[model samples]
Target: MAAEAVPAPRREAWERRTTVPLVVLGVVFIVAYTIYVLAPWIPRGPGSLLFFALLAAWVVFVVDVIVRISLTPRGGRWAFVRTHPIDVLSAIVPLFRAFRVLALLRNVPYLQRRSGAAVRANIIIYGSTYAIVFVYFIALATLQAERNAPGATITTFGDAIWWAIVTIATVGYGDMYPVTAEGRFYAVFLMVGGVAIVGTASATIISYIGEKVSEVHARHGNSGSAASDQEKGPIIEPPGRAIQDAIDEAGAVDDEHGG
Candidate 1:
């Protein structure tokens, strides 16, 4: 008797339900950060809302990260933590003071396989991240430089935010030029960094477009080849096989009749 074959172990399916909350949390973070950065335009009462939203987002992000880590493969958890200590820190770090933005990089692997969607989503994410960081740094530098200067314009958080936006966008209308030496230095840095950021954004958009085009071309080529093969019909059997079989049957019939 033949020996029975052992069945292969089944691989686990990717659990979308487990990851859905994490993805939602990431989206919430993105949205809350956007609102936080734009809080200058909101009224004081509404600005508090932005702060509360940020707090909520941070909490959600921490919970999501913990859930994700829990769901990760046992060996993968250690490897990820070893390589991404920042991610671990972001989860536990103090609110509004930690380098939690660095946690965005952790999503790269999950997004990478999605190709077109990944490219577009990354462009948006990185663009937002760049904007948020640029605003924070510029505001910090501007406030530090101009806060004590006589007759300096950037007196409040809103003014500083506005200045940061203008500087980082390179639309410096000179309506709020930095008067102090440190402010001037920051301005120069912002100008250069702004240009680099814009260039990087353009490159990302172009690369995404190129990836989309390549995907379309690949799909078209595959479909065309499949259609062409289908039109050509099956090549395994000769065209004359049916007729040959019929002729052989006829001959057999005649031989039987004559016999």
Candidate 2:
């Protein structure tokens, strides 16, 4: 247990340092991919520069994956790699490389603490944050892969964004859907991711509300006990007598004489 705790903190620190840089790299990859997609509209030299830059960013992602695996403090590197298939797919597929940025969304294990409220806040924040990123990146990836394919309805970035929002919301209006293999693969990821976001947010909310309700009930219980104690006054030990109201001796004598 003690040894296991060591790796989590180190992994968290590494994640904090690298997560921002990974997002930046993802943005750069996005710009490069945009140029690559619009290659016909630009000069060949600038497009080639963008392509090479994109490749360099991919190299960075590859390095990031290797470092993460090394930092795991376990010998299951191959199993980890197999589980994180996105790392592999992003390295091999040019268009899919930008999607590797999504890995940053998954560092919650290290960021979470024992506080339920804090964990709940993290859950909602992470869920909302990743949902937004996925919508944006998945939109671009879907467009790049589907725009030129046969029977592709997502021809414009506008359509792509719209489709992405609908799909990520799990609305599926049927107005736009992926035609090619890459687009469909990305869509599947989007659907699953959307469901996960919703589920996390819902569970966190329920847990938070439950915690609050329990706290309120506990306070009420304490207050009720306090009121009962006040009604009874403070308890005295058996060796001492509790004070009573003073007797009216004159009035008692007058009442006895009248009797």
Give one clash count per candidate, in the order shown.
0, 0
Tens digits of per-residue lDDT, candidate 1, 1-259, equal 1111222122112223434544455455655554544444664354576567657766765765576566565546655456556456556543222334434454568556666677667667766775686667567657756877998988666788888788778788777777888788777867887888788888887987888899899998887777876686776757599789889999999999999
Which residue runs does candidate 2 get wrong by more than 4 Å?
1-24, 34-40, 43-47, 67-76, 79-112, 228-259
Ten-residue region with minimum lDDT total, candidate 1: 1-10
C-alpha positional error of residue 174 in candidate 2 after TM-score superposition, expressed in Å: 1.0
Instruction: List TM-score per model, in order.
Output: 0.45, 0.67
* Consecutive 10-residue window with the lowest summed lDDT within model 2: 238-247
- The lDDT values for all models are 0.64, 0.75
Clashes by residue pair, model 1: none
Per-residue lDDT over 91-181 for candidate 2, one digit per residue giving the tens place of the 0 to 100 score: 6765456655655555566445757766666667666766776787788888889998999999988999999888878899998999999
Name the lDDT value of residue 150 in candidate 2. 93
